[model samples]
Target: MSGPLSSLRVLDFSTLLPGPYATMLLADMGAEVLRIEAPDRVDLTKVMPPFDGTFSTAFSYLTRGKETLSLNLKEDGAADRIKELVKDYDVVVEQFRPGVMDRLGIGYETLKAINPALIYCSITGYGQTGPYRDRAGHDINYLSIAGVSSHCGRADSGPPPMGIEIADVAGGSHHAVMGILAAVIQRQQTGEGQFVDISMTDAAFALNAMSGAACLAGGIEQKPETGLLNGGSFYDYYQTRDDRWLSVGSLEPQFSARLCDTLGLSEMKGLALSQKPADQNALKEAIAGKVREKDLAEWQSIFAEQDACVEPVLTISEAAEHPQLKARGMVIEVDRGDGELQRQLGCPIRFV
Candidate 1:
């Protein structure tokens, strides 16, 4: 089926993960996204590994439905060509440091003057204007500054870094997409376009608001794996006898009781323990011992018969092949020339 954004035309001038991911979402929903690449610069996709020998799987996954256009903005007439294209486009997305676009003479101000109805979005580390606006940073740097890294990992271990580019994708790409969509809605009423300045640091802070609230409320300085949601006795991942993993989320009193009952730990029912260090550690260990008694599938069956909010953790490949995922079409395959098929995470929205 055609999508709501089918008629929207997007000019994507950003590169790497965040910008590409944002535009990829739009393209999946049928927006016409034209990716602008520099003619002289080697596509970083070529350098990054996990390549299928000829092209980067990462690049293929991100740029599936978008058209590629090579242009040298510094070359004569190239800037003018881009200006012409921008006039006809509904949205423009770019991810450069604060002054880089302005120096190039193609910043939002310059473009909006020509296309008054354009939704121009700029995604950056700090923001367009700030004390750290000129500072160079990446996903890790942004997350560290946002205080997100403070609450990650175990208490004994230093705050472990995230495996994925949380700030780049969650903070930058998702935030930029949200701003662009909001801008589109606002334009419908005001009959004029506006600039969207998205700061990766601000986005990361927003994502970490729940943890921030705990700190603000004078809740114990969130030690990793100790918070309500992190991994307490009632809510944690357990290793089964077969070495598979099962995740339990029985936080509420009723649910926690149900979990204990399901495991035949009736003696531990209605159990209340102090949040003190020693008490908490003992409780976590007691629960872990019970969970390790069975295989993951056995735990899955047990939880299925109860409302304990428990589940077996699946690997990426296993998740892709899962019945629920397949039924919902959450994993899709795209054909990329030469009889090659590429699989990727599918569009999350269901229009029903």
Candidate 2:
């Protein structure tokens, strides 16, 4: 309770990653968050593997700096308890289905009557309205429905399974935080609260960004391995002799020139800038062949001082120990309320 949002109080009715992550960010920035959980229900994060003591490491990390209250919203006076709490809490974040909160008698309008300045944010897969509003979905489904998976990954292999939950985190959690903060600002101006609806699929569609603009306005459909950044040029991951990968993003003329010279394929520098499929393929193949000649460590040593945007694709453990991330304080130790500290990922935002 010591950062920029120290004045704010949040009542979190979210269980899994999306809602919890949003609230976690707020908590990290010094918002006092109270997580309301049902006594009979079990959050999957609590039982997932890699436990520090009794609780999962992820649960400890996501719920960091937040207090928990076991309140069965189905009980006789549960809604009353929430209504009473809303008078003091500044915000409410929930991730249940569209009508579930209403059925429980703690929906936005019901609580807004008690506290007109309360910012109520709802996070869901498809949104409050739409054909798929009530449909259950995970990260992959949202990405696919939003057309994100269509233009990613190799065309022959289709979209590869993502290592991270992009739709859940980037779409649902991030959009929920943005919407809630925007509503909070609006409340400061108008002295009235509003319902912020966040749809993961909708956010994922918006994540299309440049590609979406090209497809909609320019009438150019983007395809896998065709875009400038999406593996169309030599700006892709190439495997090393040690089976490790190195990401090469030498797209600009100067960087590509340095990269080609470093790889001893200086003749292919012009091909690196080509938009034609044949030329790009030739350059990519040449770089890949040359890169495979050395192990990751050898290449790392060779390019250690180079400024060509060539770097190894480190594993999670490797990334944790990397000098840059270490310098930036991405990994941190959090108090576990028992005089012991648990190592966790730190919040990325740097409030100067």
Candidate 3:
């Protein structure tokens, strides 16, 4: 059967991660996406590492099941061509700084005039009218400004390094999809499309929900490595004897009891949620001592039949091939557009 969004048509003018990723979700649900680009100014991701005969692995994964067209916006009569094209496209997604699209004569207002029912979405760093709207920023910058990185990392160390772009994927792409779908729903009622302004900084800052509560409710700024979920409590990752890491998430009292009992540290059961630095450190050290006694594999195996949420921290390749993940069909192969197939993370949502 055709996917849920098979009837939708998307004109994607964004490049790189955020916009492409949002449109990729649409494509996965069977939306017809036309990735518009300038011939000279290609999407930066197209040149990213691990190429499949010049097609970037990252780009291939992002642009799966989509059509591409190169049109120089600055070319003569290009604006008219886009105007005519927008007449048929249901949704338009762009990632240019605030006024760039207006200058290119394809701004939301101009397109809205052409297609009054068009759902236009703009994903940017700071947003349309902010002082930093015109400023250039990326994932790390967004995370930093949004107070997300501030709460991340260890007590003495700075923000822990991230293996992936959280701000781009979670903040920008997710919010864009949500906004687009919401707008689509609203349009069904009003028959008039709306504009969605998605700021990576705004979306990332919203992620500060758990910590922001501490600040907003009582002006309590969450210091680095202090909150329960932010490396404060005994819930944390420990390095194993083999140098690999294991995530320790024995948060509930029962789980904590089970973990402590398994580690022969019954004394740590009471200190699982301790706020006292001394107590927390003592419990952490005790857990660390036990964790270091065994390799990650051994620790994982020991916890396999237990209630505690301890598991080995796998590398990207390891995670991709993990039996549990495979059992859920979270990983799947897609054509690389070159007869070769590549394994990439599949969509998590399921209709059934």
Candidate 4:
């Protein structure tokens, strides 16, 4: 069967991670995504290492099921060609700085004149109208500006660089996709499309979630190793005897009891719920000491049938080989445009 977004057509003008990722999601759902890249400009992903024969694995995965067209936007007739494509395309996703698209004569207003029903989504670092709109920024910059990196890492190390581009994918790409879909729904009702301005900094600021709410409403600031979910409580990762780690999220009372009983610390289970720094630290240390007595494999076997929220911390390759992921079919093989299938992470959205 065709995917849910079979009727949608997307013109992806973004590069690197954010916009391409958004288009990748749309393409996974059967949307016709045409990625437009500059002929002279080189996308870093295209030349990134770890190539699958001729194509970069990262580039191949991101551009899966999408058509590509190379065009020099500054050259004559380029804007005309884009305008022609916009007539048929349902959505336009761009990742340019503030007025770059306007300078190229393919800005939202210019395209809206051609296609009134065009859903134009722009993903930027600081948004289109902010003072930092013209300023260049990356994932780390956005996270730092949004107060995410401030409370993320350890107290001594400040903020550690993220393994993944959280601000780029979670903030920009996700919000852009959500805005585009929401605009599509609105367009269905009103027959007029709207502009979607997705700022990574803005979205990252919103990602504070519980911490932001508390700080805004309760005047409580969350620091590293201070928040319960951050690292304050015993509900954290512990190192095993083999030096491997296991995440323990036994937050609820019943789960905590089970975890404590399993670790032979049933007497100290009450300390798990204590908010006092001393009590929390004592319990955290106790659990850490107990966990270090056994290897990860032993702990895994011990917690196999346990109800507590305990799981081993697996590497990326290990995670790909995990049984749960395999059972859920989280790994998929997509064609690399040459009939060669490369393994990639499957779409998490499940439709019956």
Reference-based lDDT, each prediction:
0.83, 0.93, 0.90, 0.93
Model 3 CA deviation exceeding 4 Å by range: none
Candidate 3, pairs of clashing residues:
none
Candidate 3 per-residue lDDT, tens place, 27-87, comes to 9888999989789886778897778765888888898889988899999999999999999
> What's each prediction's TM-score?
0.93, 0.98, 0.97, 0.98
> How many clashes in candidate 2?
0
For candidate 4, lDDT tens digit of each residue in 1-352?
1699999999999999999999999998889999998999999999999899677998998998899999999999999999999999999999988889999999999999999999999999999896898899999999999999888888888888999999999999899989999999999999999999999999999999999999999999999999999888887999999999999999999999999999999999889888899999999999999999999999999999999999999998999999999999999987777777889998887788
Taking all chains together, the TM-score of candidate 1 against the true structure is 0.93
Q: What lDDT score goes with residue 280 in model 4?
A: 91
Instruction: Give the range of the ten consecutive residues with the poorest summed lDDT in model 1.
Output: 269-278
Q: Output the TM-score of candidate 3.
A: 0.97
Clashes of each: 0, 0, 0, 0
Mind sharing the TM-score for model 2? 0.98
Per-model root-mean-square deviation over C-alphas: 2.0, 0.9, 1.2, 1.0
Better of 1 and 2 by lDDT: 2
